[model samples]
Target: MPNAIPTTELYLIAMAIIFCVPYLIWRLGRTDYFAPLVVVQIVTGILLGPGVLGAIFPDYYQFVFTKDVIQSLNGLAWWAVMLFVWLAGIELDLGEAWKQRRESAVTAGMALGMPLVFGSLAALALIQFPGWIGEKAQSWQFVLGIGMAAAVTALPILVLLMEKMDILRTPLGQRILRYASLDDIAIWAVLAVVVMDWARLERQAIFIAAFVPACFLFRRFMTRLPERDRWYIALIWLAVVSFGADWCGLHYMVGAFLAGVVMDHHWFDRDKLDTLRHNVLLVMMPVFFLSTGLRTSWEVGGAVVFLAAGFLLAMQILGKQAGVHLAGRLLGWKRGEASVIGWLLQTKALIEIIFATVLLDKGIITSATFTALLLMALASTMLTVPIVTPKLQRMRELISRDA
Candidate 1:
């Protein structure tokens, strides 16, 4: 199958094109207008999706928007996210992460707390939406997932943007880094609690139980071992990890993420995992993101849909603004600093979008509600493209001057 072309190969090719087109837009727009690339990517997805282009090609749109294809790609996309999230843990310079712990916690609490409340309520209100809305999203679990995702921030995206603007090394940038890192970790832990399947949860517990002591033991063992054979042991664990999270309620990637954190000490060896993560991120991240676009269908209809959509936007703006504002006040940070940090966390992402899709597929939510939530998420993320530039410029001036 790897080498053979299926009848549906064209759809796959189209999907691939959709994926890269956004990145190109991002690159091209990087210096031109405000977050032009981000805007283009999301708009491109909407255009290619049933929302726009899907209307033009309803029949073929089936292949493009099929449950299986979009779902599988979403899976792959989230897997890439897992690797990236895992890599985040491994790359953590803990000393630096720890230095700003106080502000990190303050900011994280602001970002994480408010949105969680807003999203959960949004999810609940969606059920009351009483329309062709996604019924699957009406549940406590599904609602919780939506809230958690909304309440959370996209660490990888934020980090990438901060680096691009050269804010990461600055004090405010540093605060964002610390705060975003903590937020990322919180996201993982929340996912684990809400979504881990039975098998996955079991393994997760074992990994958690053994992690600290095992790290200590591995540290000692590795120091004493002849350098020649460490690769063999590492290879075995890699295989174990590939299937590890899969057995859990989570994906193999989640297991892979935990594997990364557990094996963080292997950072010195670097070659094996870093190379794998780089490959995964480069090849699959965009694909995963594109898949998100494809799965989005405007066909979902209902009064609740509009309500959910409006609520999502409101929560995103209000939640971030409130969270960051509070965190800033708590820390005596400037209004601009808190506002920027708040915006950073509330942004939506492909992984959480896909994860919500997963819940929808499992019949965990009603279709209308699921579609509504998807619409909300897509809108929130797409809006970020427009909002980011103004937020970043103001933050840079305030933070740079503060420094």
Candidate 2:
């Protein structure tokens, strides 16, 4: 035992690997043009996962990701992701979407609806094969779950990319946020449906019934608290609600999003909120990314997974483009505007991964299906900046357009 490397040391080594590998590749390779640091981190995670690194270097993988070390990493990953999801919910700008109700409704509806339909069709085809569907999943659950994953837009990553491109505060940026905000709500609601446990129906009903009053009370209490106290109290609310949701078999993430959605973003200073998000991504999210990557598998064969990913990617891209273009025509949008919106709206990186994780956790999809969804997400996100940059360059006026 004296010759043993302590679990603490192993954990630190794992953390070091988690942060260093992605950072160096991103910095040295200058991949920010096509792949941002976040995307690189995600890809690095897949490389470090059991399917890749473990397959190549089983001893090293086992040493660094021993059960104890993985548990520690997973603990951090859960909390980090909860905070990230909470922030996304807090930043939802429903008021703006309402103000532009007619246009936002038409655009957000088509943007979300089309991919959903197409992706559902893809899912139906996927379920025709063995090893793609989860053991406990119903046919409907698997299809809807996969469909929803395809339609997801990673709002946080979208914000980061837009900020990097210097369009975050522009009129065009706000318009896109409005559309994404509406779609975000729909995505989670659909997830709640997909994960619903009939056996826990009573518990779920009770949770919802109590949550309404609790949300009202929490909002009232939050308004009276000082900003510093509000921050601390918000974390408490996040833990309580997330626990309650999980206890009711609805999943903790559903609670986390609800926790943030009820709380007003105006309670915290915008600058500080932005800083917290950046800090969380800087210090904690890589762990989440790494843990997520660890869940990837190729039990169904690597070729099959990639082909599935390719099919899902094509469906996602085509569906999103068709939806946005249809809306653009109906709304009388300027030429090329729908193309920019379509490509941007299709960036699925984090949220899609999160959705797939939920589906996998709930036994609605197999690990192979999860791997395919993850690849589809990475490809969609990486395509965003590269494709959108030139379009924006050509249509410089689109950046300033309010509608």
Candidate 3:
């Protein structure tokens, strides 16, 4: 039988419209204020959810964003995350990072190792936090998970921050970008293992390992074809590879990411890549971000909420700084340079936030902790834009003086 139209559709419908409106304003070149756009989405989501407005109008809330509907929303959220991750992977040309192997390794180490260790340790202090939101868990596990979430680097945000600060062309900026790129690679691979869609992971690892080699091998075999035809044929094969990755359990995004990386060394028209990105911005990302904000809860917070938020932010800052200092010493790099790298990697994003939620659903963590963790990520990304650029500039001053 054809399914009846869900009455709960309206709440979701409201969510989409409210969240996208600000993003649209930002996109139309009307707002220099970008962070507020994301904040509004998060706030509006809380305002309309059962946590607040729904409490006053029980029937109205249930009629729209019912349990079933919310469940569906949650499912779609993860899918969007997977796609986001895939797109994230596609953004960096992994092979290029491989060429700068030692620097890249050092950069990745300083970027991830610091925040991770500190965040986890700090999280241990938070494991016993009491809360009724999210599926709850022991303090230690909760802290460990929260620690990872706080330490994460949001690659997309870092790129935006770079352009916003007009530092993209600077020597230091290039190095940070390279560091950010390396962080993206490590984070994505870590996510694959931790988030646990094994089928996807297995297939994804194979594609990533095989992609560069297979592409070159195919290039040699297709040597007889006209250059134009050979390239397009390979693109088709790339799409097939993307499809294969999707089918294997990773999501089509991992496939798309692999496809993009494989094509990086190819001499494609620059306009084509721009067009592809344009289309994605026009449609997919808006949908993804809007959908994410719609699920945020504003009313479910309390006094401890502030504590959770503050702790996470502090950890992100101090932990990353410590990481940079440690890594710089180990790699025989200067303290200032290492600090710049640390600041750059302090931002978190959709991947970590979404992963925590996934863990919450499985009862591995409590709702209070998860909610606190999500806030930690939002704060990490939102705050880094203001913190990193200025701090790095100061570092440069110190460096020039030392020189």
* Candidate that scores best on lDDT: 2
Number of clashes recorded per candidate: 15, 0, 14
* C-alpha lDDT score of every prediction, in listed order: 0.62, 0.93, 0.60
lDDT of 1 by residue, 13-97 (tens): 7666676777777776663344435445545665676655677888767655556566666666666666665565565454666
The candidate scoring highest on TM-score is 2
261-296 in candidate 3: lDDT tens per residue?
A: 544434445565445544544444444554444444
Model 2 RMSD in Å is 1.9
lDDT of model 2 at position 38: 91
Each candidate's TM vs. the true structure?
0.76, 0.98, 0.70
Tens digit per residue, CA lDDT, model 2, 174-199: 99999999999999999999998889
Return the TM-score for candidate 3, rounded to 2 decimals.
0.70
Q: What is the lDDT of residue 49 in candidate 2?
A: 97
Superposed model 3: Cα runs more than 4 Å off: 1-16, 19-48, 52-82, 128-145, 197-275, 278-282, 293-301, 329-338, 357-367, 392-403
Task: Give the poorly placed runs of model 2, Cα more than 4 Å off.
Answer: 1-3, 397-403
